[model samples]
Target: MSENRQIAQEIIEAVGGKDNIVSAAHCATRLRMMVKDKEKIDLQKVENIDKVKGAFFNSGQFQIILGTGTVNRIYDEVRQLGVTGTTKAEHAKEAAKSGNAFQRAVRSFGDVFVPIIPVLVATGLFMGLRGLVMQEKILASFGLTPDHISENFILFTQVLTDTAFIFLPALIAWSTFRVFGGTSVIGLVLGLMLVSPALPNAWAVAGGDAQPIMFLGFIPVLGYQGSVLPAFIAGVIGAKLEQKIRKRVPETLDLILTPFLTLLVMIILALFVIGPVFHTVEELILAGTVAVLELPFGLSGLFIGFVHQIIVITGVHHIFNLLEIQLLEKFGSNPFNAIITCAIAAQGGAALAVGLKTKSKKLKALALPSSLSAFLGITEPAIFGVNLRYVKPFIMGLIGGAAGGFAASIFGLKATGMAITVIPGTLLYLNGQILLYLFVNLIAIGVAFALTWTFGYTENLKQQIENDSKAA
Candidate 1:
């Protein structure tokens, strides 16, 4: 009777009823279905479903773009229809056959990181606010100096802004453990131990202001503040090790011994080998990322800006959080955020252009909200729900993003945080570069809009949507 249920019912029928489905999973914006036979699917009907944006078969799955909140409801309804065929374990086993090694790895990375995006988004917003509040000129305007501001007040704000990054390893560790079927608490505790007060802060060690706590007089050990790869590797090893140990440990003592042995073994590995090896690899990555950002003629920004959304689509963009953290640690700024913001804005602009151009009420309805979602720093709706469906708009957005990225690099524009973008991103530039931030976003939007308006979205597509709506 309800709209989402009705839509889900239609989708279930179009996918050849429950019998054809092998497994189904929903991401933030898409309903990923593994059907026994692709020939059973009604591709056009799926595309024409009222709120559906697009549909395609890829990686041995029939994936339909249902868009954010909408996907969850439809997913629930389909599950309620008893269409399921595989358990989580079975699905994982089957999924291993769906893609090449690289694709599988990217999907696994997404599985590990996507759930924590909200926390990262919140952290970026807090970082932006801190940048604004700590601006000397702004503070002076309010009859306050850096010294005049209460140290306690500053510390409170710092806690709000810095807690996430300071303990990022814990969050990642917990999530990774959950994904990999390990006990989350042990993972969390192990992460905390990596950044314990007993060790020097990673940033301080990098700055040469603090000495590493030497291990065995040959190896150096320090806290892993603002580190990703180490925590990620540690979590994987911890999870696998725990599962193996669980099988060997006695059932009676399992409760006591499993956790103890898991922690003991994991901690030793994390501190001694995994932590040092991954930390070194992370440093090389950081150095390479910085070198690319500093490349001449803004080539780095142009290329990254154009491809950033594609990276996000694959879900490996979380890896950049490490790069951003390192950049902020070393230089106190994040140019990557500024460049990525332009990419996001371009997608928003493209969707908005489609909203304005489309004659069909259904197209207009879908396009507008998708555009707004993109501007709010969530682009799944715009990218999956609108732009990619139309095709040309997505390409136009990339061009716009490249232009904006070029301008940002030319001016050396930077942000104080990561994750947040577009309107909320304004807070990031509030320290002294708000105008430049606005200018870059405006340029991205303008270029994307102009291009999309000129060449994206054919009249045939508009008429087709109108016809589909009428039939429904």
Candidate 2:
């Protein structure tokens, strides 16, 4: 057998043999397994296995840090050993079984929002480009003024950037409906009604150029353009309402009447009640986030930066994605991105220190590449794999992250984008602030590295070789 296959076999044996595995999945850098009984397996033996970097249990899965290149191979080997594997949906379902109400809400929000993140990423890239092209120097370099730019060119770019936010309600409604077991097409139709041309455009109403039309002579209604919660609530109500309505209708008519009544009832509820109430709620949430960001002298940034990775570890961090999208929509920039970048950088720095200081060759092999991936904005390898395993280095990383986050807020650092960070995030600051962005990364990395190397390292470095020896 190949060396990795040998290691994979050992991994199966180490984890209470193949019968203990209920399900398995792999993300970019870890082998995630949901096993039947915790007491049946030996975590120490798993750690001791050759080619394994680290292991930890999170959100109902025993995740082994196998890195990207190796995880797939090991995962495939285990699957061939005749155990049934699970999908991401199963993972989500498993995660749902384990959290508190707040954690469950956050994970559900992740299930709804993760599908929407890609388009937002694409839009953020365009926002950065728009910033790039609008620069006076760039326009001058191209021998054009703002007014001299063709209207057609401007309109095309505006469509590219604005479509996501303008129709964000539709996307959320669709995804939320899918998650809640509804027919997505009808959910989309209901979502479109919330933003249709027939209603007063929300931005225009807010800007005083238009007014909400009074529905039923007393209820005021306007377009829910760029709205989030109204669509989400509408989707849930519509979906559940459809299931309930379907039971009373005849089977032959069920197909036709179910979706029809679902959309119709939802449209009324959305326009008259859900839209008005949740729009207010969303505004409050947005305002709350703004108030936090506006806190005196970077306290908000420092607090968020320090705890952000800890939030990530809990697997509930997508709650802040709502705040972030709101920030980008209202302010046209996000300082949260800067704070998060610092948190990610600090993780990289701590991992690098672990890689450098450890006398064990296995530690060296895992930590260095994991550190590189962490610097590039993927921190699971560095955090779960290296720093968190060591304990103190992770704490040092939080301190470093806090320092970077405080500096980010004090400096008023802003990103024109969301989602991309560390290496790829350089795109967001290309409008003459790239140097400051790099500087933030440097400060985060330098402080984290210095502190971890200085105090985070323990004398137990030689023990990992015995615990996880390769030449077995």
Candidate 3:
């Protein structure tokens, strides 16, 4: 039998045979299975399967890390073995049913924000490129100065770098509405209304260049350009309102009246109530975050870096999306990104150490690839497959993260983007902070590697793994 088929057959038996699997699916790097009985599955046996990096029960699904190309093939083989095939969305819905209320809420936030990250990353890269080409030294080498740069050229660059942030509310609202089961187009329209040109610009109002329009002679109103919370709240309210309207309206009028009422009610509520209220809430949140990051002597960085990966293991790391967005909106730079990158890089470093030190070829195969994955900004494989398996390496990585975070704070390093980190993260620092960014990541990797090499790995762990393999 082919290796994938053989692996699939073993996985079926390990998870209590085809009878126990209700549905099966594959994501980019893992096979997700919604099983009928968790107790019947042999978790250790599943993890021990050759070419399976790791296996974990998360969010109601048994997810097996089988790497990229391998997972889809394995999934196909699993289906051929009598397991039912399901889409990732269907699997996610099933998985979502397993988590508590808080976990579900966090997962919803993740679903909303993930689709928006790519555009922001692109915009950040554009900003970095613009900064690079606009440097006075570089401009001088080209026999040009800031004044010699054409106004039209500058305008084009601004369009590239600034458009995503300026329309951030529209993107957030659209995604939020979709996640909430509302009409996404309506949500997009509502978000656009929040930043309509008719209203005074948010930035201009903040900077005293313009004043907010007063409603009820007390409440100040302006365009919510570059805002996060207000748009999110508006999307939720609009979606819920639309659903309610759709249910009550007659079939003939439902199409017209549902959207009309949803928009009419949402627009007033958003501008008059939600906008003013949540805008304040967002500012307070931003203030608190800044305060924490600015804590004396890099204590905040040390604390955050040390615990960040631990948080990732819980699967709620998506919560940082809100904070990162707020920071980018307020400061146009994300120190949170710099701090978190250290934590991420440290995971890879620790994994690299384990890969280098282990005697077993199987471990060497898993650790090296997982470590490379972490360096490129995806750490799940490294964290779950390697570092967490050996507790000491994970702790060593945390220490390394703290060291790098401390360095980041001291240097005041910040990124021009969110989402992308570690190696691809270099793009964010291209605006002139590249050297400092490299130093921070290097420190994180170096410290984690050194600590894990010196103290984390041991012959006992290798012997234990080899024994397990032999038993299997």
Please tell me which predicted candidate would have the highest lDDT against the true structure.
3
TM-score of each: 0.88, 0.94, 0.97
- Clash numbers, per candidate: 0, 1, 0
Best model per TM-score: 3
Residues 1-472 of candidate 1: C-alpha lDDT, one tens digit per residue: 9888889889988989888898788777778888888899998788778788777776567878877788888888888888774454456556657777877766666567766666766766676777777789888899887888788988898787678778988888988898788998988998898889888988788788999888899778899987888998999989999999999998999999999999898888888899899989988998899899999999988998899988876655766766777786557688998899999999999999999988878778888988888899888778876788668899999998998998888889888776688998887787778899889888999999999998877777677667776876
Model 2's C-alpha root-mean-square deviation from the true structure amounts to 2.1
Candidate 2, 1-107: lDDT as tens digits:
98877888888888888889888888777888888887877887787677687788767778898877788888888788776777768776885677478777777
CA lDDT of each prediction against the hidden true structure: 0.83, 0.85, 0.91
Clashing pairs in 3: none
The clash number for model 2 is 1
Q: What's the CA RMSD for each of the models? A: 3.1, 2.1, 1.3
What shift in Å separates residue 341 of candidate 2 from its native position after superposition?
Answer: 0.9
Sort all candidates by TM-score, best to worst.
3, 2, 1
